[model samples]
Target: MSMGVGIGRREITGMVVGAVVLALLPMVVQDSYYRHLLIMVFIYGIVASSWDLSLGYAGIFNFGHMALFGIGLYTYGLATTLLGISPWIALLAGGVLAALAAALISLPILRLKGIYVVLVTFAFGQLVVQLIISQSDYTGGNQGLVRIPSFHIPGHNLMRDHKLGFYYIALILLCCSTVFLRLMVRSRLGLAIRALRDNEEYATSRGISISRQRLITMAGSAVFTGLAGAFYGAYFRNASTDVFGASLTTLLLSMVLLGGISTIYGSLLAALLLTIFSEMIAGLGAWRPIVIGVLIILVMLAYPGGLYGAIAAAARALRRLGRRQASP
Candidate 1:
């Protein structure tokens, strides 16, 4: 109990210090380009962390998570640009819509096991992408939506002034997502999800409702992913079918696996690092994807538990070494 309390206090302290540093980053960095990259990092981090909630924690193996995100992008984009709705309200609406979609999708596939669930979800995502492409008149089709409005304070354009406002907004979203997911992983629901993941039959025998747990997790994951999508549309001022593509799904999965499955903050950190790395290699042109693929393969082979797991292992080793030295 004391050890757990000590660890909890350390985590709290780390989070507080990290939050303070992030809050002051804009003031210290002063580079609009870097700020933009950091904003992308935060956006992807939110999406990745939310994805981890279902995939890692609950073992849902959802491959269409990006589709939920795409739904939010289109929902918010269309609501604001076509229907003249407030962006803030549209953001909330997008999340609700995505959550509803997730619940609906999970309903039929609740009984599916393993790869079947993955395939169905992947097909669902493809279906969404195709629908977006087919409905060019409304969705902007292949050309994509353009001239979407940015977040603003009436007279002040947030995007016009160095993107600082968007940065802060993304920061707040990331922080909220991190805290929410952290709490979720420690909650009773999370415990039940883990139980189901580890032994579905045992969990079900113990009176844990499999469908109920999955539906809840699916909906919860979609909510944050949708919000991230809404933010993406606002930040980039565009919506494209690419948001629902397999590439992004793969990238996000890589982030989660590379960071450490079931570790929310680790996934967030991986998103940040990977986003920055991708930016750095952008000049490599066509070779970028190959390089990233190789790097991911190497990391997976070397550190199966991912960067976070490797770091934890190293810390444990160092502590052990220190203990031995003290005994001598």
Candidate 2:
């Protein structure tokens, strides 16, 4: 059976090649600052791709996706700072808690659609922020949690290596996430998700349980998103309510759009592109955001399919030219 474009051989080969290059990056680019940015790119890539799973595939306007990330972040923060647990254990705990939160939120939004889904999810995020603030002594409220634990090695110190350990960890996490999302989207469940997204009524008539699928869709998407969140906290050694803010939400949303909806890998590409691009224009200071916003708008207007679409178009054009040349 044929799968989606995201699962094609060409795309898979590209992913593999890209992964190899990224794996070799640390050796070539030893600068800690650049490595820091790449780690962030990996983290954002995981979050954005997970968001794509729900928003792009299932067509769920889950505005609280970042909320799930925050849950993981706080879970790690509190676990390490309060409970005195290992950072490794706290990381997994974070993902688990986020997944649970996603499942719970899915129940309420199951019957809702479109903008209502957006509203409910967005409200859920705000509710989480308020809860964290109300529990200031534990969460540090507005000040957030600081001096959170970082990952430890048996012999070597993590900090001494210029973030090499964290970079590899982030890369591995992103790779796992990308593989998971792609597999899910190419599976029977993924087909049902797309079907439901296109026509809920028709999908239901075919015996696809809207509730079950929707629940899985929401929960599955949250897993890596939560992990990424936990990683963010661990990497930064802190947790902040600021994660639930609109800025991150907007940036990730732009990634999903700029990458091309329904293509899991596209979001990752967008993450890499946007994160680096945003940093490159940092000298613009006040104008940096304006430049990015304008670029995104122009790109979207010119190519509705985002980067993936533009690439596909260029590929098609090259093939056409090749064929013409061969015919002569």
Which one wins on lDDT? 2
Candidate 2, after superposition: displacement of residue 201 in Å?
1.9
Q: Write the per-residue lDDT of candidate 1 for residues 206-294, one digit (tens) a residue.
A: 99999999999999999988988998999889999878764566678889988898989889889989999989989998687788888
Top TM-score model: 1
lDDT of 2 by residue, 47-129 (tens): 99999999999999999999999999999999999999999999899889999999999999998988999999999999999
- All candidates' lDDT scores? 0.88, 0.91
Can you give the TM-score per candidate against the true fold? 0.92, 0.91
Q: For candidate 1, what is the lDDT?
A: 0.88
